[model samples]
Target: MRVNADFTKRVAVHFDRNDWIASPAAGVERKMLDRIGEEVARATTIVRFAPGSAFAAHTHDGGEEYLVLDGVFQDETGDFPAGSYVRNPPTSSHTPSAKEGATILVKLHQFDPEDRTEIRRSITGDSNLQLFKDSREDVRVLNLSPGEKLDLDAVDGLELFVIAGSVQESDEEFSVWDWLRLPPGARSTALAGAEGARIWIKSGHLSQMI
Candidate 1:
């Protein structure tokens, strides 16, 4: 059940080229970026919930993190609109759904076993936002101006998702919702397009996992 499972290679997934696969839950679907395991696995994905759809209550034994891309995501704790970021560390439980449909980028089973801190916030209108940082990884969201260049170092592996606009790396261009992963020790640069770009980045984590 592995997709882009090689930790030593670079991988890129463009939004327009990937197909949505239906999830076990009704009216829910996912675009798997990387996966390693069965149902409950170490994975990165884009999930979409149809209106009135919900997933069964579940506990995250290995942790869960997500950023709402559109619409509203709701649970017993509260309702989260687009641009919201949430981290439910190990042992957290919740029933998640979207009353009006929603899209989110999520990472699962990727947290340190000792991490139990919870974070929930909105990142709207931010030029740059640091979501989290630990010895294992650094997570951030950045908004770029037109034709801007972003230098990235992958000393311990780096991953980025294009949330809006387009970015070019080497000879390849990434549009909205695209994802890219670089192996440890790699270095790359991304140049924004005419409309600029908004991206989420996570680095220094793969070495710990691999």
Candidate 2:
């Protein structure tokens, strides 16, 4: 059950919201971008929880990072609305539900054991690009305007998810919910299109996975 499991190659791909398929969970679905192993796997996915749907409690042996795209997502911690970014470190457990529905971009089992910091952020903050991991600036979010470009210099690996607006790089035009991953030495300069773009970037972790 592997999808785009190669960690050594550079990949530049895009998927629309409608490209998703149903998940095993009733009232839920997924658009899987990358995966390794089975149910409990190293994966990156866009999960949509139907109204009044919930998932059973589960433990994150590796870690989990997620961003709410729309609607409200709830857990034991709190209710997270759109524009919320959250990270749950290794060994974290929770039961997730969305009373009104929600679409979220989530990454599972993708954190280093040493990276045990838990963070939650809302879009209301003035810090457009806030670093979740201290010192190295590995994981963060960015708010961009039309015609703006983010240069990637000496990045060993990179992952970008367009949360809003249209984003472009070379010939790839990405609207909301599009994700792109690049391996070591790959060029991934993101340029915003007409409506501008807000993106989540995970840099320097792919090539150095722990």
Against the true structure, whose TM-score is highest?
1
* Per-residue alpha-carbon lDDT of candidate 2 for residues 152-209, written as tens digits (9 for 90 to 100): 6526678888777888886688887787887777765778998888788887777664
> For model 1, which pairs clash?
none
In candidate 2, list every pair of residues with a backbone clash. none
> TM per model?
0.97, 0.91
Please state the error at residue 47 of candidate 1 in Å.
Answer: 0.6
Query: 11-129, model 1: which lDDT tens digit per residue?
Result: 99987799999999999999999999988999999999999999999999999999999999999999999989999999999999999999999999999999998999988884799
